[model samples]
Target: MGNAIHDNDSQMLYLKKRLNMFLEVLESVDPESTNLDDIDRMIEMVDDLEVKVHQFKKSE
Candidate 1:
């Protein structure tokens, strides 16, 4: 039981780290001077994260 909970906790922490990194990149973007390239990159990042979450859910 403890091991299972620890595993889940570790997974959650890693996910949180990914999310934080995404947020950092987004927050660093200059909204006033935003470009199509930046928009595309952000979209790609979110899409990647979405796929990861979907896979994680399917695993459980």
Candidate 2:
């Protein structure tokens, strides 16, 4: 039980860190010069975040 709790805490921390990184990238974007690749990258980030959330749910 204790190990499971520790795993959960670690996973949450990782997700939080990833989320902050995604937010930072978004904040740095310049909409005026944005292109297909930029949009694709953002979408990929969101998809990765979603996958991580689903994985966390399954672990619980």
Candidate 3:
């Protein structure tokens, strides 16, 4: 049980880190010349991370 809890915590931390990185990338993109493809990819990554976080919570 302790291991499971620890693993869950680690997963949450990783998700948060990934989300922050994605946000940073999004912020770095210039509004006047942002690539739609890059935005789409980042959005997908955020969605994927969200799903993983949700799954981790459910498992807990």
Best by TM-score: 2
- Per-residue lDDT tens digits of candidate 1, residues 10-57? 667767887998999999998999999999989998898787677666
1 or 3, greater by TM-score: 1
Superposition error at 23 for model 1 (Å): 0.8
**Model 2 regions lying over 4 Å from their true place:** 1-6
Clashes of each: 0, 0, 0
| lDDT head-to-head 2 vs 3, winner | 2
Ranked by TM-score, the better of candidates 2 and 3 is: 2
lDDT at position 53, candidate 2: 87
- TM per candidate: 0.77, 0.86, 0.73
Best by lDDT: 2
lDDT of each: 0.77, 0.86, 0.78
Residue 11 CA displacement from its true place in model 2, Å: 0.9
Q: Report residue 31 deviation for candidate 1 (angstroms).
A: 1.1
lDDT of 2: 0.86
Cα lDDT for residue 2, model 2?
32
Candidate 1: minimum summed lDDT over ten consecutive residues — where?
1-10
Model 1: how far residue 53 lies from native, Å: 0.5
- The local lDDT score (0 to 100) that residue 11 gets in candidate 3 is 81
Can you write out model 3's per-residue Cα lDDT over 1-60, one digit (the tens) per residue?
134434766887777788888888888888888788987988898898888778787877
